[model samples]
Target: MGKPTGFLEYKREAPQKKDPFERTKNWQEFQLFMPEDKLRQQGARCMDCAIPFCQAGTTMAGSGEIGCPVYNLIPEWNDLVYRGKWREALDRLHKTNNFPEFTGRVCPAPCEGSCTVALNGDPVTIKSIEYHIVERGFQEGWIQPEPPKTRTGKHVAVVGSGPAGLAAAAQLNKAGHTVTVFERDDRIGGLLTYGIPDVKLANEVVERRVQLLEAEGITFKTEVEIGVDITAEELETSFDAVILATGATKPREVQAPGKELNGIHYAMDFLTANTKSLLNSQLADGEFISAKGKHVIVIGGGDTGADCITTSIRHGAASVIQFDINKQKGAMRSGDNVWPLYPIIHTVEDAHKEAMAVYGKDPRSYMLQTKAFFGNQDGQVTGLQTVEVTTELKNGQKIRTEIPGTERTWKADLILLAIGFTGPEQELLQQLGIETTSRTTVKAPYGKYTTSKPGIFAAGDNRRGQSLVVWAIHEGREAARECDRYLMGSTRLP
Candidate 1:
């Protein structure tokens, strides 16, 4: 420990964010970097807990609450960074996580919540320090492709190039296996390049990582649909093992009166199209989904919804209204969600802050229910008919009841549906004859990713449904280990 008592001496310092008014004008990340010395001081705040729960990654007994799923060695890395050992810190981070940049930028940082320091004052700025370590690694040319010394005869095929798919391919390639990642999109990285907004994660970060993976001898095939272009049985015979990291791509739909309006779009479609159009000139032409000078109504108050709000504000939207069906959460942790659990608190992310700057108040409206979508002459969505609703549990079922005399209408030219996804797309999964569970996720046992058929494995969102990028990376690594063991009767991978 560089400074054993540094936690007492220094106050918690996070990355400074740009002013809301100034930041909303441009589509870029708002979090300004902290000085190196200040970051080191923040790193020094990691107390020497007897049992570090930050890295435990275990679900609490009877509660089902878990720590970091990738099992990050939090304290070790924090101490390394605190001691000014940047190279060593990067090495330690890469031990468990293949992509810290991705997680550091967007991860909710449950590790901080479970930290011992969080019980009293502020927790260690673990995520910021992590971001610095990885970013410096690239700047210092420490991050390089590590081609396997010896080539194993085994060949493996990884479907999807998101976090999970990339992790699996990286590990498998490192283990001397010829790895090929198949992506349906034009770009190699799946959601990383499309679903997430560039303001959150710039496209260059994803491209750089993909380039490293390519340098490491992993072949990537973009714009190729697996089931439609390539058959499952063909993959079975072609590659010794096939790893299905095809994420949950199907968007959940909202049933309303005028659901078939022209202006209504799924969040993924909106976000993906925007990023795609920005990247390629071909797609940028013709009526791009612009929110400029228009009132935008975003449904579903999740991360994707926040992203939509932020993106719309960046597009010079006149106003934005974010709606959530659930009640507003408390400022502090609730009774049901105690210590060490990822607390469900009222969080105003960067998007909400931007919206507040543009509009008078925060754009979030809780307990708001959409009664119907009103369309114009050409079947284009013009407004949303909504009502205030109360939730109740009756006869072992939960329901939402509309409040009397509370019907209202909000003008909206663009309506983005940011409600969560509903498992993986069925056409490809069904065509491959893979069985899905009741929740529609691929039927695969936890920890062991083997499907009903031998030599077929599934992981990530396809297996666990829509989840965090960290969980997807964890699942990918686990599935890779299982697939390796299944193929060669043993594996050295963790």
Candidate 2:
């Protein structure tokens, strides 16, 4: 898109990050700005493929996400950045993504995974270029509140202040509709403000975008929950349309012996409290579950597990280890992990780097499954028992087996469960008589987003279960478009 031989001339150089040991001491973001020249060089790596799978927005045959869920104009922006047109690149970015800042920080970069350049070596630094584009836009004062010229006089009540709700609110407001977002938490940015660790998606980043949304005339109400503070009937009578963006927060609990130990905590509970306490009084509140001076063991593996390890290290844990039930992936992609599909390979995350710097080794124990938890006489957790597992393919399905005589016990005072989530909470769904799938997520088709009753819609994690922030934003925008159509019999949202 930029230069024909750019991919061949330049090697991939990821955006610079703060030193692991130093950054872990504080909760500030670890990602540093890249110089514009370096960014342009990376942008030039975007080879003009006959068909760029990076923006396909569809899942190929893979074990992971294949492309960008938001379907970002990746090549266009890449070319723009290569040409040093920062403002035009930003405009292209904002056309598809409501919040590039969030995705750039937190998304796993499936776009990079499916890049045409990635077919051989590394992909273009699309994520960093996107981040720099938006941040530069903010720095140059190109991004300001552009409130709609006229109001539709239609009211939209959005539940949850997470990415999905915020996207819906923003888009609806752009269409000149009055939108009010209701959040049960004390603050806005549901998962953005709480679920993620600050070192990854800093709270300030979220607050800044939320403030811009407020300036654009979207109303946000905190500590106000639907089905508790206000009834579903009351909401239907008050607002013209309702959108439940309440995320899939019901965490999957570990089923093991002695599970009721005092030190066991859900990942979100620990992360939320840590961020809250950090923001409230720089953690002086002592309101969060601390890993200080304690041996910590995190169950499950993924972003959440890594987050737990990083947080534990920051809290000055004596020692930390993570348990993963699956076998470790290879360094390179397997044959089945074909091109355009997300490569299933092992990679080190920021948490692993920090933990390695602190513990002298990787904090992960693959193929180990937690068997039981052990509690002391005081009902506080002392440790946990785990066993080695062997996995094999059987009739196109994976079969797991416990290895005999491979059971081991590890000492730990704090155990954090980062397994995953089941689905959204059921209070509002039940109250509103909305049907859910077998997965317990809200029953709404992907594009339509209509619930059992008209004027009531569902989107984001509540409808799609646990997914990426970009996907949540996509659904939020789509749902708002549908809601607009329902209200006005026509729509212009994209």
Estimate the TM-score of every prediction.
0.96, 0.98
Tens digit per residue, CA lDDT, model 1, 1-494: 67889889999889898998898766677778778888888988998678887877767644445568899888888888888899999999999999999998999888877888888888788888889889989989999989999888999999999989999999898888999999989997788889898888988999999999999999999988898889877877899998899999888889889989988989888898888887776335633588889889999989999999988887888889999988999999888677777667898888888888888789999888888999889998899899998988677466999889988999999999998989988777776688899989999998999887788899999999999999999999999999889877899999
lDDT of 2 by residue, 41-159 (tens): 99898886778889888874425577788889999999999999999999999999999999999988888989988888998888888899999999999999999999989999999
Model 2 lDDT, full chain set? 0.91
lDDT of 2 at 112: 90
Task: Give the CA lDDT, 0 to 100, for residue 175 in model 1.
Answer: 84
- Scored by lDDT, the top model is 2
- Shift of residue 187 alpha carbon in model 1, Å: 0.3
lDDT of each: 0.87, 0.91
Model 2 / residue 303 / CA error / Å:
0.3
* Clash statistics: count for each candidate: 0, 0
Clashing residue pairs, backbone N/CA/C < 3 A, model 2: none
- Model 1 residue 308 lDDT? 95
Give stretches of model 1 more than 4 Å off: 60-64, 282-287, 392-398
